[model samples]
Target: MPEIKKYLSIVALGENRDKLARDLVGAIARRGCEVNECRITPLGDHFSAAMLLAGNWSAMGKMESALPGLAEHLGLAIQFQHARPAEPQTDFRPYAAEVVAPQQPRLLGELLDFFTEQETNVVEVSSQAYDSGLTGAAMCTLHMALQVPVNHHPQTLRDAFMDVCDDLHADGLLDPIKT
Candidate 1:
């Protein structure tokens, strides 16, 4: 059986997240580690990357040492930490959702609260706020991957989320992720 080492997730942001990602991945590979997954997103003037990596425990120190130089050279901060392994809960259903609305304080907090109240487990979340250039309206958008217990019917969660969206005057959707 292969050793199950702890996973390390890195989130880096800077003027050039792509370069940072490439450099970081190269550095990790050089240290004999493998990157499992990486995703990059443009956050207005900045770029961000979320990466999942795993390898021999002994290589962690070498990788950590390389991080500072890359972070400094890239002119941004690179943060990493051990990630919790996924739960093998067959009773949980996967879901993908999004919420879009005019930018406002407390919108994100309220949505998170609803998720907590519903006993949903958030796997991944990314959000951005920007101006609708045509309308000049400030808009915020949230995308999330979730695991909802099978006991909670999809429609039930949708209805509850819709209620929150309605109250917040936002548009949202909750749909099962196709496995």
Candidate 2:
């Protein structure tokens, strides 16, 4: 039997600065942990990141023990939890959903609710609001990575999704993710 590798899920927030990413990744490398997946971005004046670290039991423990000191030294707010590898989902197909529209309250919530009603699994979501350069109108854009069940007909789902977008006064697209 293969040994089960340990995993750690970490989220950190700190004031944006140079060398922060290098320092954080270096710390993980020094402790012998490998970053399996990560998303780092600047949000306003702060830098935020979420990472999944993988390693053997000893390496995981070492990294976990060092987190508090690292957080203090870097002036970051850090949180971590034990995690397990995601099980393969052969019955699901990857898809991407994109929406762009005039900014409106509850727009994101309504879109999320629609997906929830269909029992679709939303794996990742990113959204931003800005003023359109042409019209100087407030606008919002949302992109989501989804694991859609194969049992749902793609055409049917796309049609339904389009209807929801029309009702929300948003332009949207739902399509398969190209590798």
Candidate 3:
């Protein structure tokens, strides 16, 4: 198999996060590339992300072509490149995920603590879950950098996260892991 690691950076702004993710994934999938993970960074100005994908070189080309239109639609600059491989391989498959949790209407000390303890860096987080008419909640997006080891069944990560949530009393709404 020809293994390769591709790094794609996408910038999308606005309060509508669902739309941004949907557009990016849709555009990329249409090109035959599967997004392995997206780490969104909220830096007070805009949304930035480093996405990892696995697919053939042809899919990479298709994604590159469609990125510009998506960027324009979201009003953000898009920069992408492939990771330097020490050896030739088909594509890179990583174990990662984007988890969203709903915090209490009160302060987010507990929620923030979970991110810190888990070592899952926060790319971007919002304290406005209720702004869209949902119940009072704060949401965070974590980008897990370390991929799962190749030879063992995955454990430790999710349980650790759940332990944190249990201590902090935060409710996790979405926890779909890509392992």
Q: Where in model 3 is the C-alpha error above 4 Å?
A: 1-18, 84-179
Task: Please give each candidate's TM-score.
Answer: 0.81, 0.96, 0.41
* Better candidate by lDDT, 1 or 3: 1
> Residues 102-132, candidate 1, lDDT per residue (tens digit)?
9999998898889989999887888889999
Model 1 earns a TM-score of 0.81
Residues 1-179, candidate 3, lDDT per residue (tens digit)?
Answer: 65764544444454445456667677778888887766665655456566776677777777778777777777667777665333522232244444445534433565456546654444344443333246544554343433333442335656765666565554433243464
Most lDDT-accurate candidate: 2
**Candidate with best TM-score:** 2
- Write down the lDDT that model 1 would get: 0.83
- Pairs in clash, predicted candidate 1: none
Q: Rate the local accuracy (lDDT) of all candidates.
A: 0.83, 0.94, 0.55
Per-model tally of clashing residue pairs: 0, 0, 9
Candidate 2 on 1-179: residue-level lDDT in tens? Answer: 77568999999999999999889999999999999999999999998989999998999999999999999998899999999878988899999999999999988999899998988999999999999999999999999999899999999999999999999899999999989
TM-score of 2: 0.96
Residue ranges of candidate 2 with Cα displaced over 4 Å: 1-4
Give the per-residue Cα lDDT of candidate 1 at 9: 85
Q: Which pairs clash in the backbone of model 2?
A: none
CA shift of 160, model 3, Å: 24
> What lDDT is obtained when candidate 3 is compared to the true structure?
0.55
After TM-score superposition, the amount by which residue 132's alpha carbon in candidate 1 deviates from its true location, in angstroms, is 2.4
| Worst window of 10 by summed lDDT in candidate 3 | 84-93
**Lowest summed lDDT over 10 consecutive residues: which window, candidate 1?**
16-25
